[model samples]
Target: MVGRQITWISSWKPQRRTTTSNGRTPRYSHWVRYNTFYGLVFTTTLATLLLMADLIEWRATGYLFVLANRFPGTVALIVQLLAAFFGLIHVAVVCRLINYALRLRLRKASVTLDVLRTWVDMSIPRIDWDLPLRFFFPVLLVVFLSLVPAALWAGSITPFIDRTTTTGMLLLPSYEDVSLIREYPMEIGTSGPSLRTQKGFFTYSVGVQHVGNLLSSAASASSSTTGKRLVHPKLDNTQFSYIGRSYGVGAPAGLTDMSISSNSQVAGYIYQEEGYLCNVTCIYNRTSAFRLRGPVAEWIYEASGNLPDSVDSGEMSAYIGHTGDAIVAIGVAHSERSPRRYLALAAGPSYAFLNSTQCALDFTPHLFNVTVDIANLNISVVPANPIPDFNPQRNLTRTVMRQFELLSNDLTNLYVSLLGDALNASIAAYNMSRPPNAGRDPVSVSEEAATLAGLTNSITAMADDMLAAYASAQLMVGKTFTQKRDVQVYLYGLQFGQRVYIYAIFVFNLLVLGAVAGEAVRTRGWRELGRFNYLDPRDLVIAASRGGEGVAWAADGLARRHSKKKKGAGEKRKSMKHVWLLSDPDEGNGSLSIRMKGDGEGHVGIVVRSPLFPPSPDPEKGERGGGGGGGFEDGGDAVDADKRAAQREWDRRRRQKQRVGLFGSM
Candidate 1:
């Protein structure tokens, strides 16, 4: 009974006037009429907010770098100001609408029939007629506001953001930045530096080497690379192009093996012992192993007497640039398990040192370099604020150990503050868009910003803490293992992967929200156009003009019920037509008859069959019976066997009948 009553109540449309049990008259005879203005305003406001939010997010993520190499922070500020101004207008409009609604309610006479009708026309309850809109609106809004933006960013903006961010990191000076001096180009075939003349001297090259993870199966694909397809050739393999040289010679040849050198340049030989693990040696032109036999120089021996591998993961390593030749050297017993992968430097003599020295350097406009110790959990230096009196030899251990807690706290606080400021700005804009004293009270802009900022900071802190915890645990684990086992190296890989996953999930959630929000806004437009649902007036009009059959089954339930039945009928008809058109009539047409006779159910039966496979009459039976039609057989086992043999013989004859041409008698 309740279902029937609900169905009856739900059958009323906006265009049809109806009254409730309380004698309340419907407005516009449809649900769309009642909620049109509310829907329109709400949708417009929501869309504006979404756009503003997107702008802020885009700016924050430095998405504008794809257009020009402008300062991202400046661009973000401009976007924020513009969004703020637009948000102000939005708030003003909402305020006006709220005022108008209040005034209208106050002026209307209470309980009067005319007033009641007016109220019904203007009430939010009008949305009830288009109940599906209500059901889907919130879902759409959530998706649009959150997910769609993320998707758009990912598809169009996020790549740019990532590109710029990554570029900033790679552009970090791998070698000392010295003033450039113009010099005449060296002769193409002339040698600049010879290792032979400098017999008693040793040189080391200090540079950053980037190792990448590539699947072993992709080695062939590596051969076909043009190499020049990226912003930085050394950083991205896709941009690499071969120089005129052998696989182990010349400019491109020597650089092919290394992704990024300490000087942010490519090295020729890249060696990886495992997935996402690599060892790179930077070279300029010559392809021969720098340490190998050369007329100018001789490498007595390597620190480990082997190619770079896990054993070299922690040793302080350097590339020696002597004259024109370069050689990479590593310390014999440097700690690879140290959290800080120290830079190798040589001040004087052949002896080189890998130092965990911290320097104040903004590696990029947005990124900073931080140096920390793995053994003591100390912050050697924050690049954002490097100490002036920094000395690696005498003060590194003392300074780092002494100021560890202070430096860590300061860095953590700074990150939190920056994130908080951004969040606060967004919340402020949100507040400016809400009507004064309307609905639930808007959160204080400062508080909301603070809350968001705290969360972001907490997340970053958690990551940092995890790294710290893992490093300490790894140090202990390394000591416990006597066979040069370093768990810290593997832990870093896992930690990096987890970080990527978290970022990916966040982006996914935002994309989902944006999509939902976009749909909600689109639905509002349909509501305004008297098309509350996809199957409403628009469908009927389109179908009518397009010359399709129309039915009275437009009422929701009736429409669905009849539509389902029609679909079933259509399917059944399609199946019947296919059967009639396709099945073959030939093989075993007499088999069923034989089986029936053998079973002693001997009544003559008619079986419907495909036109393509109509039964064939037995020629022998027809001739014997003298009747034009029926073929018959006895029901005994001997008869059955005879019939089966006859059927097999018929099959053999049929196969023979379809031959293309008679073979010449030979």
Candidate 2:
């Protein structure tokens, strides 16, 4: 085509189709009722939504939790009511089917009008207790029974469903590499590491953990465990402008709030490095292999500096004073020649006789358990144990001995005394009240050894807290700190009881769907047209006042019963039951009316066989026996022609009613 230079159509569009049509109007005939259609829609939709909700439950923290950071129980309850509204619609359809079954002819149908009224009210979801239908429908009972429990679930499920998020859950964390965990922060994030040098000494500021260890028994008990020099429970952490890092046991970093919702109170925790904890074990009343040195033999009575005073005596003791006359005493053990230094606690309050029992502190490593509560980051540290190695490059034994070395002498007793006292006050002896008189009491050797064993456990817990504080602070240093490792934390999610309610709602809707669908299917070909289908005031009045005569007795019986009169058998609301269907005696030609006969004293026959589906009339049968079928017609004067005309009209009415569908429209 290019060589021949032929003209070709570039674009061809399809012809537009016309929506307008010119033909006879058509009427739609639905096989199922409108209420039934709505019910099916609601039930199936709710089921799908429930399944979807369950599948994505873990992620609902950011989505469905719109109203409050906390679980919105009121919102959930409101949503449940909204879903139940659809079930209410289906229930209405079910009530209609039940009414048809109760009033069916070709069988006895003698229910009181009050029973009908009660069921109609129940369809609207009321507390009306109709005695007749009470035991008939189990599904109806569920609505009443579940009310109280459903309300309780709405209120209680919030706290029950509190949950944690980890790597396995929907939202996962990216942990910073902790390969540089060997590095330690010597000071808080603010101070420098260098000591001012002079010929006398290279004087430097000690790290927080060192200064914290120097606190008295009571002060160190609370402060040192949290890496503070003072016991300040309300101490605020550093914000973004200035980072705060603890050298002992405290929050390493106070991170910016990263919660998904402003209302959400999310808490997170991360893993930290292993810590070197001091555990003391001593054999009470045991003799030592080594004797005291020449210079250490004579004990001096010195006043207690910063170390704790004896709680019973309420006075300070010297760091190395003889146990008999000292507030706190210290005794150096096997210090003459040993690679690992050991401090003994045999010295009493005055003369090699501190009241404290014999104990030796040993260093060990354990995993740290650190917790960080954010949305306002709060830190908490718990014990780490189960005896394992932390693989440290630095020996905590040597570092601790040097840090607490006696400044005046080569003695190493003062360090262990403070460490033991701090832990003993808080955990080992655990007498926060400092109850007195136990010191004077005699104790067995086993009791003495048992006392030191308690100190071992205390050291393990305190060490873990210290490690958590140290490792977290390393991250906040922003200088030498390098890595972080991910850990599990608590996050908002669904609870077991909450899930149970959701599944229960799904199942309830299924029951409603099945009930309504079953009723619709059973009556697909049958529709009660005319006044038989309605229960409104106008319809009930027309049925009661059959043809042109008023239902004067019905109104009179209600009044008379309340008036305290001795009424006749058929003059009460309960006594009047008889009703029969007949050709509309009103102006309308092809309608039906249910009427009471002679104040309901006369019994009536009920026929439920549809007029359209009635058996074909045989010519041999006497079909034209009744003539001029209006009430009290003159049968004797009727001719054969008028009788035939009446039968012919009845046949046409029957054909018209047959064309109606379940929804009562052609």
Candidate 3:
């Protein structure tokens, strides 16, 4: 039985041989040739889709992350959920495409195998059962690996988004409205030397005598028996300047003249001799310039040596005497000017009266009395320039003169009234000293003298009080000073939230890079088709044929079952086997032939035949049977031998070609 089997296998041939008119062995088709070409397109498209999906997910997640910081907690949660849902959809679609590609590869392998069998009598390779598992597991592993970076990116970016998007939010617990105070100390007046200063000490060289004195002197002369006697015998035209004199006191040196010291005083005496009377006025016009100390000094200089414009007008006790006695006076002054300094009369009736020409020219015998009354009494001080429309010099002169007249008259009357008893006593004493008949009262001379003495003491006391008041008002004219201090104000500014958002963007970009890298690795390295080996159909066929007669028969039966349906009449015929005959044309009269035995319908066959030497022609029949001149014929040992030789040559060439194709030129 074994020997018969061996012989049968050795004699086995294809049912039909197909060949071109010029016979040559056909090249074997490469396994996976079509699959590789198409597979590359499929994989590229899938990878692109996956990359796009990842990019979209990355962008969507980034947007959601920003919203998570800006919106309220519930709203942010909803946005995050929507993002995750969409992202999952994208991932699912990509995974599905990957799965489809894997399945397509398996199907293509089966299809290719079948197609290849029609051209070559060979088995097609089958994909390994575990291929799908291998592909899926790696994809899963890549996804898992991607998650590490994705999660890290997400974690890193969340805080950054929160910080950037929610920055400056009023709801933050640490948010605060803060105030800052700033203080600036300012000095607003000239500090080095006062405009009224000359060398150093306060200059009292300029002064103004009371106008009341001049008026009083004039009155006294007018009431006296002496007709226009000189009131001040010591005065002379040479020793004084008149009010109209160019060089006189208070007269401007030039049209644009500026006085070194504004402080000035005027005093004069009236000389009445006979019918003509002369006025001799003296002016102390120079200031005792000095450095003013303290905070108000600079202010004083800045204000042009005058009190601040805001100074209040009222009566105040001020030190005016050379002995520094506090006397009541009316004027304007600021508390901030100099607290420790004596109150200097800024402007008042006293100051005007002292500076007036009438007072300067007055020569009343009771001048001291009138002045004492004015000093002890409260009076309104007319400002130096009280009204802008009126001339200050003229108004001041008129006002001071009027006040002086009234005062002088009133004091004279008071003195006259007070001296009534004394005068009466004097008259009586004079009568007694004279003839008895002279009408005289019996009054004591001693009593009369006592009354006169008391009156004199009272007058002296009044004079002293008036002098003090006048002195104080003259001290505070024309000086300016002020002090400055700084105050702080509160303001608001922006804080923390802006910084957090910047970091989130950075993290999202990192995640995008990771996703691209993972996809590249999966497509180019892990799921690469070349990495796995598939069973070739040709190898399968050879294995099946060598297994046994039953295996070979079964394979043949299977191929027959899958054959194409019968063709139309005009269709070209089909064959299951391709054969080739190889020979050296130079060999003398050699011939080759091939044949196979099989059922006429739906069967496969193959044959080959060759002859080494040409046979001679039969002279009687005139025919050649086993040489180049003869064609293929059945039932001949010589034809069988020729078929065997051609088959062997074809097999040798096919093996050589396959070896060369597989391992390069060998």
Best by TM-score: 2
Clashes of each: 58, 25, 61
Q: Which tens-of-lDDT digit does each residue in 1-666 have in candidate 1?
A: 111111112233334444455432323333432342333343344444444444344232223333323555665455455444433433333333322342223222112112222222232212222212223243334333333332332232222221101121111111021111111122343311112111111111001001011111111111122332111111112233222111111111112112222222111121111000011121121221212222233322222222222243433222223321222222222232232222121111211111111111111111122221222222221223223321222211211121221222122221132222322333343344445553465554454343333222222222222222122221222222111211111001001112233244345434434544454475442221221111233432332222111111112222333346669787452221111122332111211111110011111211111111122233535412111112222211234445456445544553442211111010
Candidate 1 error regions (>4 Å) = 1-63, 66-78, 85-93, 108-666
1 against 2, candidate with superior TM-score: 2
How well does candidate 2 score on lDDT at residue 101?
47
> Once model 3 is optimally superposed onto the true structure by TM-score, how far is the C-alpha of residue 480 displaced, in angstroms?
27
Instruction: Encode model 3's per-residue lDDT on 421-540: one tens digit a residue.
Output: 222233333333433433354653443343333322222222222222122112222122111111111111112122223243234433443544565466442222221111333433
User: Sorted by TM-score, highest first, which candidate order results?
Assistant: 2, 1, 3
Can you give the TM-score per candidate against the true fold?
0.18, 0.54, 0.17
C-alpha lDDT of candidate 3 relative to the true structure? 0.24
On residues 1-666, what C-alpha lDDT tens digit does candidate 2 reach at each position?
101111111121112211224311111134333535565575567556655655565434545444544556776666466544544555555555554443332112223233444434544445434322332243356346435333433332332345556531111111133333322333456432322222111112222333443333223333223232322221223431111222133333343223321335344544443455555454443453222221223443443211121223222223443332322333332121232334334333332322343445555654446555544444555446644643333333333332332311222252334443453554434332223554455752244343454443443333333343334333333224443344555666543235666566566657756765676567442332111322445434433333222112222323433344325544454431222233211111112212221112111211112222111223454333421112212232356675456446545654453221111221
TM match of model 1 to true structure: 0.18
Q: Candidate 3, 24: how far from true, in Å?
A: 45
